[model samples]
Target: MTAWRCVFADGPVDGKVVLVSGGAGAVGRYAIQFAKLGGARVIATVGNAEAAASASGAGADLVLNRHVDDLATAIAGFTGDANGRGVDRFVEVAFGANLELIVKTISPNGVVASYASDAVPEPKLPFWPLVMLDVTIRFVLVYVMPKQAHLEAAEAINSALEAKQLTHLIGRTLPLASIVEAHEAVERGDLGKTILVLP
Candidate 1:
């Protein structure tokens, strides 16, 4: 989130319907809340009831089971009443895994903004549809930056946070000794911040 999460504070993701793939995961939890606070509608995909509860409590508008009978139909149904025909954007955690279905579900000119990729390196991008729909694929690289710009952005974000306008959805809290297990849970899609408490 140190990188991709900035999308929210920057307002580029404001007021959009962002379909989050790992919507109940660590990043997903915060992404959901931040999007809502930013005035966007959040459609999150959770693995089960507990995750759904957590997401809803954190402010997600709709939390759907990822094991749904039909992802496309479900997504389409969710965004049916959208001001726009389909989702305005996607905060995708599994872009490669969900690319085909995302393409089928998104409206023309919709964008898939992704960050997670531990598998399937270099998958082919849908160039034609992207061009036809005028979709933009944006990547966030956090390492490269000038300190001045970073400070400016940070100041702005801090101002928003101080105003209580930017909400952060923090998930499970873990004890210091359980850090490894906590990390595992996050990788397994346990949503929210894996905070370690020191005794």
Candidate 2:
């Protein structure tokens, strides 16, 4: 959290319009709030109204429905661009699903910070355009977290929570016995924070 907050809130996140695809999920939720805290207009995309509300409530300036036929077009609309290049930064969850559009939407010298890029499809790179604009791509790995890192993340989270600036969508809480159901619930794709009940 500290590193993310530093890299975002106190560092790269300021003065930029940031886009968060899958922005209603756990990581995205915090990312939105963190971005807002440091003064960034956030464009969040969700799968439904529930997610939209959650993201908007969490301080996203704009929310778009991912189910919309043209997700990239919607982003362009928000950026006030007919072709994209309005965004200054992007926090992407699914690169294969979103990179092509994000690349086009970002302004010159913009960056794409990717946290998770699981199976979506084969990604095609626009090497020509990227070379022209000098856009940068970064991939974040969560496994590197240490105790000190967790402490920083906790502080950032607490700061947002204390300021009443953070909002999250919690689907359900199940006891350990229902772990199977919990796993299946996660597959629903619309759920967030399926917290397990500890004894």
Candidate 3:
């Protein structure tokens, strides 16, 4: 629901340059797939080599390490938006942390859909820059989204599943008896999703 809401709910993603931050994470992976399936050019930012690989596997046209890459230059070069505006839509994970980069790389009138901001819960925005660019900032919370939005996401997910376009990255599968171990893996920030099966 979060991915669908970020990628499809706002507007047409087809042919747009969509940027997904933390593309190796669960939500980021789905967002990348959904944007690509929607006919958009997708770029993703990862923190490490494993994450880069994961993002690439998920069909991101380009995956850059946010910690290492010169995001502004790389994004501009990729989109050929020399005037400092490149990304058409941004699926943001760290809204506060990436605010500077987003302001520098986002095209005028671009939409930024952000889900999490744990790092900076009370982030201050560069109000004038965003306002000057006429950017739209959307805060998404799956639990509180409108019923219609939920229905739309469910239908879209079902369609993708039927078409076999959606894929799951299961990092580990364990018997329900090892639920504690599974929980620990997640708490350790293990990559991919962990599933616990009932005996």
Candidate 4:
């Protein structure tokens, strides 16, 4: 909710073509549902078939297998265009790793809301191409968002929850005794949320 409402920080999502990278993660899954709740057509990219299934279950209109598929072509096909110009808003996770491909698939004036960029801490921006396309980049960190934005995001999330439009996906749940295991699972890149629960 915070990422969707604050990171994107744009107007209504109605009829927009929104692309979500890392669609199997907690934030990505929530973003997918939030976008759908706002009436946007969502396209999610996942690393594997299992992740793809998770994204599909979260209400993505189309799920692309990022490991094997050409993201540009996939976006083009999803948008009914041979030309790679469909994405209006992009929620990026592997921003550093996929920036070039993201730029290629996004439409003019499109916005990219990114959180993580671990792979490439210092990516060289495509100044000319981004300038030509008028793309907007927004970076979000949950802790740094303003209090008012947090309130609004909370309200938005509550509304979605009340409407039964939002649900958290738990890929694995571990007892408190297995906290180390929980961390290990996360480190191993397990799909969805890995929760450590107390009895």
Candidate 5:
């Protein structure tokens, strides 16, 4: 909810293109659905065919297999432009690793709203590329968000959940005593979300 509203707050999102990276992950999955619900065409990137299926199931208009496809070329074709004149909003997960690609693939004045950048804790950003595009890079960390924004996000999330527009994919569930197993299941990427029940 916050991802959809905050990233595209500056402009209209209806009929726009939203590119979600790591679309099989928890956040990406919801972003895909939210973008679709908002009438935007969604293009999602995934690590494999299985993840591609997951993204597609989440209502992504196009699912790019990053392992096999040329991402830049794919974006160009998907957007119907020669220069890959890219997406209006980017819901980024691997911000550090894909920073350069984000710069190249976002439209002028686009927004790259990222929540994670663990790959490069201290990344050296490319000043020129960002300045040239006049883009906005918004980092979303729920813990530090303003109270109002947090409340809005929570309300939006609840609405979506209540409407059945959002769903959690629990890959595995184990009792609290098996927390170690739950963690291990999470490490095995295919399992969507591992749950440790307290009882």
Candidate 6:
């Protein structure tokens, strides 16, 4: 629902350049797939080799290390827009940490759909720059999404699943008795999805 809301709610992503930050993470991975499925060119950023591989597997056209020194230049090069007019849509995981980068790289009138901001829960925005770019900042929380949005997302997900267009990555699966272990893994930021099976 979060991915669908971020990728499709604003408009069709066809032919657009969509950037997914933390593209190996759960939401980021889904966003990458959805953007690709919608015919958008996708660029995903990750912190490690494993994450880079995961994002690539999820169908990102370009996967870059988020810690690169000149991220904006790299993005511009990938988009082939020398003018630094970056992605049309951004699915951000660390909105606060990436605010400056977003402001620098997002195209005019682009939309930024952010789901998490653990790094800085309260971030100060570069108001003038964002305003000048006419950027739309959307904070998404799946639990509070509108009923209609949920329905729309569910339908899309079902269609995608039926068509075998979606894939899930299970990092670990543990019996119900091992729930505490599963919780610990999640707290440690284990990669992929963790599932607890009921015996």
Model 6 per-residue lDDT tens digits across residues 16-135: 999999999989999999999999999999998999999999999999998754789888998988778869999999999999889888999999999999999899999999999899
Tens-place lDDT digits, model 1, residues 118-176: 56557678778667777767554445545655776577557666987645556678899
Which candidate's TM-score is highest?
3
lDDT of each: 0.67, 0.75, 0.93, 0.84, 0.80, 0.92
Off by over 4 Å in 5: 1-12, 188-190
* Number of the top-ranking candidate, with lDDT as the measure: 3
Please give the lDDT score at residue 48 for candidate 1. Answer: 81
- What's the CA RMSD of model 4 in angstroms? 1.5
Q: How far is 61's C-alpha from truth in model 1 (Å)?
A: 1.5
* Tens digit per residue, CA lDDT, model 5, 105-177: 8888888888887788667888899879898888877677778777767776788888888766777778999
Candidate 5 clashes between residue pairs 3 or more apart in a chain or in different chains: none
For residues 6-38, write the lDDT of model 2, one tens digit per residue: 236324576778888777887888788788877
CA error at residue 181 for candidate 3, angstroms: 1.1
lDDT of 3 by residue, 78-173 (tens): 999878698999999999999999999999999999999879889999999999999999999999999999999999999999999987789999
Candidate 3: residue pairs that collide: none
lDDT score of residue 6 within candidate 2: 29
Compute the lDDT for candidate 2. 0.75
**Greater-lDDT candidate between 2 and 3:** 3
Off by over 4 Å in 6: none
TM-score of 2: 0.83
Clashing pairs in 6: none
Error of 2 at 103 (Å): 2.4
